[model samples]
Target: MARTEFPAKATHAQTRAHNASLVLRALYDLGPISRAAIARLTGLTRTSVGELVAELEQDGLAQEVGRGPSTGGKAPTLVSLIDDARHMVTLDLGERTFTAALLNLRGEIQRRATRNLDGADGDAAVALVHDLIDELLAGPHSPILGIGVGTPGIVDSEGTIRWAVNLSWTDLPLGKRLAAHYNLPTVVANDSRAAAFATFLFEGEDRPTNLIAIKVGHGIGAGLVLDGQLFDGDGFGAGEIGHIVIEPDGAPCHCGRFGCLETVASVPAILRRAFFQAAESGVRIPQSIEAIAAAAAAGDELALGVVRAAGRALGMAVASLTGALDVRRIVVLGSATVLGEPWFEAIRDEARRRTLATLARDTEVVNGGPADDAVLLGTCALLLTRELGLTVRR
Candidate 1:
């Protein structure tokens, strides 16, 4: 039997923070609501709700929007969140490019900037990240709430990058460094986990209690959301599925592994396979994923084969995930979604074939189509959840 460890008891400050978060969450989700209604919804006392609302008003996070309809004797004053009360600077350190954006409390991007990495690595890549942030911050924006980053790597909770093979980063204290430099709270997380949270939050009113979001691009990885919370394992590497070995005697991976999932299902992997097949068949060597997708759509056997093979690889991964976690909702996103229907069909077929019949029947794999901004938005989600307590579940 396994032993279970419980969390530390909440101190007075922690209790206050948690209560404040609950009250604020009520307003954020069901705002333009009266104090009595918030009290009822959150199960907090009316006095506590009032005090928290006053604090929020003083902080410019909430304000009396209007009066609600009279339920009986008199109309009650309604309070709502000031969606733009704070600004979040978010970054998506993509494989080929780095994107930064200024967003409001509602996760609406007010301004954006991009820097093509152009094969930069190590300190050079870090410099580009700084450049993008500096450019974005120079513009007009609301009061800075914090900085959030979605990067490719295994990241610890303290915002340290344990390793990011492509960027040649190892044991980097990126979050701490950024926080010290900017004098603001900072969160650094693996891109896939961030994307998973973004997907869960993007579901809005229909957000599920459990979901698995897989990002397939230059690398393959996933983020797991369980019980309405992002689940980071003991080492904060819960979703580092990209390095999972799929083929023992296959292509070499940057992580010094052979036949990792990324080697088969990632964008570069798909492209490599497609290019080789195109050349072997004496067809036009494809230059991009879009070109291969177009060819596949037009009934090119070679292109279809490449796309299906990649999807099949991903599907096998999905099967293992669902089999272990039993999460029914699986969202696939990133540069690879352009593979389209044939690719998706292959994924579904393989997942169904590999998974137990009962589990396969309920598993739904959907493309998060053209989620080009998912990483950026995901970072914003992290910031909002951590800094503002907007997405906390009771």
Candidate 2:
């Protein structure tokens, strides 16, 4: 057995911050209500809730909206979150392009910009990030909250990038450099983990406390949110499942391993399979994933076969993750998800067949489809937690 070190005892300041967060969370979820209602919902004393709300008002985070109907006497006053009080600069460093967005406190993008990296690397790649930020900062936005970045790689707690093969970056102190240069708070995290937090924070009131969100595109990765917090393994690679050697004798991975999960289940893998099929049949190769999905939907046997093969590969990985973590909510999102129903069915079937009947029967695996702005929103969630000591409940 190993020794387990518990967290340090929280100080009075920590307690106050936690209670204040509870109050803010209540307003975020069920806003425009009375201070009394927030106190009741959070189980905090009215005095504490009132003081916190006053502080928030002074900070321009909460404001009086209107009045609510009274239960028996005079109507009660309502307080609401100032969703646009602060703006967050968010970035999603994608495989081929880096996208930057200015979003309000509610995670709604106000302005957007993108830069085509086009194989930029090293210092050039880092410069592109600064360029995008400079454009956003020059635009029209009020008090800024700092910068939030979601990129591809194994990121440590302090935002050091261990490796990102395509970007040709290794052990990059990205967070520290950005913070020092920009003179604003900065948060950097693995894109997959960022997407996982976005999914969790936006999942509404009845959502589960734990989830596994798998992003499959040019590469494949899964982020584990356990007990409402990200669980980065001791090596800070907990979600690097894409490189797991699922096929000991399969094709070589960029990570120098053979038959890794990415070689079989990622978008690149599916496209490669499609190209082979098209070549064998003397048909034009799919120009994009949508083309393959279209052909499969039209009952093209070859296209369906290729799609199913990739789905089954992903399902195997999902089964392994579900068994190890026992997290029942699994969400699949990314470019490959465009394969839609046929692809999703194969994933679901293979996962159920491989996992225990009792576990599989109750498990719910859903397709989230497309990456969209998930990474951008997730990094913002991290920034909010770090800067305001509040979680993004909505």
Candidate 3:
């Protein structure tokens, strides 16, 4: 069959709108560029760029800077996104705590607040998020674009929480509820996916086209980016690696599964194992990972063993993931990965030994900093993607 090339038809209005969006996005990303420069970058005519800038200025989304460097004639005024024009509510809902931040268009968090959830159910958690959003919005800020939530679960396209084992949630319409409350667009995403988005936004400048981000925290989850885009599967739950069965009759997972990766490598799992080991040894174990890490740092053999075992388990999972995806880069985020060099070395060693030589040779596993704010930044990134019209809800 011969491939046919259709001639392009120009729709003036649509083209202009698209050009305006392109110009705005350019300025949003690379601030303070001249109109001529924007036209060159976006492939829009100078007149179109100017008109779009004017519209953005009128809409309060953009403003003019002083003047650009002189190039033979009168210097042109530089345009940039108005940082205070609009705000976004970024929420990171963890199993034990709910964190909320008010962010500007530049993804800067202006105010942050966190509260512990007394209950462990979806409704109570959602209500707490609603209250937090309300509190943040009620404070000093312009009209908010909407609320973006990062949680641990299978999030559907319509922002339904399909399953969140930690919160004991399933089939909850989170986006719809938030949108109904605020009469604005709302986005909800898996916490790991959200962290991956944040990592991409902040540290993906040198990352490969295909990347896998594994987030190890109280629970483990992953985000996969292939061809420079997040690869959410048909169920919008592509990277639920935490629940992948590593052992058929291993430790029980909150997801009602045995020997899941999360059951073996998550913070809670590690601590639980450490506690059991200490109890068996007749030693009083601390209740927090911090204490364990401190003990390990102080040359406690038991603590070191517990951490190394967790690292090995995580590495085994990573080996499986690399074999399946063969991504060029694997970014590990969370407290466990940040445990100095001992844990990282163990993970690297196991991964290199188990994964194929071809896969292991080129795959770069790096500890991703900014793990603490990854979810919040990812929530803001989700809103930014929506505002830039890069994604559409089905």
Worst 10 residues of 3 by lDDT: 385-394
Runs in model 2 with CA error above 4 Å?
A: 1-19, 39-51, 71-74
Q: Order of all candidates by TM-score, from best down to worst?
A: 3, 1, 2
Q: In order, what is each prediction's RMSD in angstroms?
A: 3.9, 3.7, 3.9
Local distance difference test, each candidate: 0.89, 0.91, 0.83
lDDT of 2 by residue, 320-377 (tens): 9988878899999988888999999999999999999989988888988796899999
lDDT of 2 at 241: 86
> How many clashing residue pairs, candidate 3?
0
Q: Give one digit per residue, the lDDT tens place, for model 3 in 310-344.
A: 88888887898898888878889987764656677
Number of the candidate with higher TM-score, 1 or 2: 1
Ranking by lDDT: 2, 1, 3
Model 2, TM vs. native: 0.91
Summarize candidate 1's per-residue lDDT along 1-394 as a digit string, tens digits: 9887555664666878888998888888888899999999989899989999999899999999889999888999999989888898999998898989998887888999999998999999999888988998899977899999999999999999999989999999999999999999999999999988888888867778999999988888899999988899998888788988888898999889899999998999999998888788888899999998999999988898899998888888999999999999999998889989999999999999999999999999999986887888888888877786676221
Looking at model 3, the pairs that clash are: none
The C-alpha stretches of model 1 lying farther than 4 A from their native spots are: 1-15, 43-47, 392-394
